[model samples]
Target: MQLNAREETPVVSVWMITYNHEKFIRQSIESVLMQKTNFPIELVIGEDCSTDGTRKIIEELEQKYPQVIKPVYHKSNVGAARNAYEFCLPKLKGKYVACLEGDDYWMDPFKLQKQVDFLEANPDYILSFHDCKVVDRDNKVLKEGRLAENFKKDLPQESIILGSLIPTNTVLFRNRVITCPKEIFSVTNNDTFLFALLGQHGKAKFSNDVQPSAYRVHDGGIWSSIDNLEKRKSGLNTYEQLYKVIDSKYKHLIKKALFTRRLMLIKQNKSVLDSIKYYINSYNYFYFGNGMYKTWLKSHYDLLKQLYRN
Candidate 1:
């Protein structure tokens, strides 16, 4: 679809990436359209050649909201990371940018306005994000309240490295606070990496008072669909890569995360060799010395029980 030029530049660009989101894309797009902001905002969608009818739906939306919706239809299915890095992010023409996946929708109409207002008032902060609700495919609220309930008003880069504290759909960050790093694409969880990268430029704020958005958990969700063990594995992989690329100050935090993941893997792993390997990897962190013997004994005991049962 050809992008319709606007008489005025958009104040915020909503970066959305979709692939096979035919079921939820409409709601996702509409939520952005419903946003009430005094400043102009554009929804820039990267439709990555969805095998389903996602592209068709986007086409219809583009036709209706020509001025507000700008979509780049990929000829082939480039994965989400590539779609965002190659197509979607580059097209953003706003002073601030927000993220929304095709499967998730915003709940609050003033979400963007509140975030932008806070950022404008507080120049020290580079990014602002709020809490969101977790819902099932049918929009049943599985969990209510903040995604990161324990998060401080001022976010630390260490907290981000430890876990995903910010919901992707609830984020509003400065457009060019830092140049998009190519290394982020190397990790499966690019959003987490991007947030960590952005955290370095300045402070990050958690808008706890703002209304929560909706985060959908479905079989089609890239991260949510996976089992707990696989999710931890993916997180471990992301942390490993992040540890190598991020600033030296953050390396310890990543290592601490790696240790925790390895310990968790030791408990979840069924294979004796894999469990032992995780135990060995856990030694890289300083905290490994604390109660590590208990973990080692427990892993061996579990393996012995499995062997006896067999």
Candidate 2:
């Protein structure tokens, strides 16, 4: 729908970041344009100098829907985290903000409206997100339900810090609820940090009742493109960074997550020194009350034996 000139301000701003997503950019943009909302919404895209035809498609769409589409064509590639945190976020001129990657698209036309309605009625909640269908590169549904099915209706900020429970494409949050830390731009998993930061201000709701969006898994996708080991390491780094900056109450959870990732890495590498170092690190980070010491000792002992045998 064409944005009315009378409605100078947008109620929702769709933040999209794209790089070499020529194959999926059109679908993603069209999905935002197709949203059925009573209030005006603007699409703010961060086109990070794609090496493909992605920019061309965005240009064509921007011209067609000039009122609803606002494009930030970067002269050079600044990576996804920087594009979102530094460029696109500052350009958002809406009460609420929703995120949609260039490779992912919203399936329901009322996606924005549903989340907006929920956030409007619930003042205590800072953000609301729904489930999403996991799809392959060819748009085949690999999973039919929520991205994180184990997630509950009332989400804790600690859970968000440990892992990604909410799908990025399905989230609609109150704009300017929290000032994003400069540390966020340095992390690989900026979205997780953003959600966790938002969670700190108030509460988060998981709208299972809302229609799910599409989360595409392709080789070109950022997180999907990485290998399992690299993904684990990335998560470990993000958790460590979060532990330093996040509130003191949430540090324990981040530490627990770190211990788990370190244990996994030690097992995979089978290094005796690494296992011993993990045991030492556990003592420094985790207290005796959490039973972390026992778990670390047992795991390291087994790893030490295996390493000797090898």
Write down the TM-score of every candidate.
0.86, 0.90
lDDT of 1 by residue, 1-310 (tens): 1233554788899999999999999999999988888888889899999999999999998888889889989998888888998777888999999999999999888889999999999888888888888898889999996554456366765565566577888999998733466766777778877877777666788887678899998988878767888877888888777777778887777777787678778768778678778877777763654555676566567656655655
Score candidate 1 by lDDT: 0.81
Clashing residue pairs in candidate 1 are: none
- Give the local distance difference test score of model 2: 0.81
By TM-score, how accurate is candidate 1? 0.86
Residue 197 of model 2, lDDT score? 69
Using TM-score, give the best candidate's number: 2
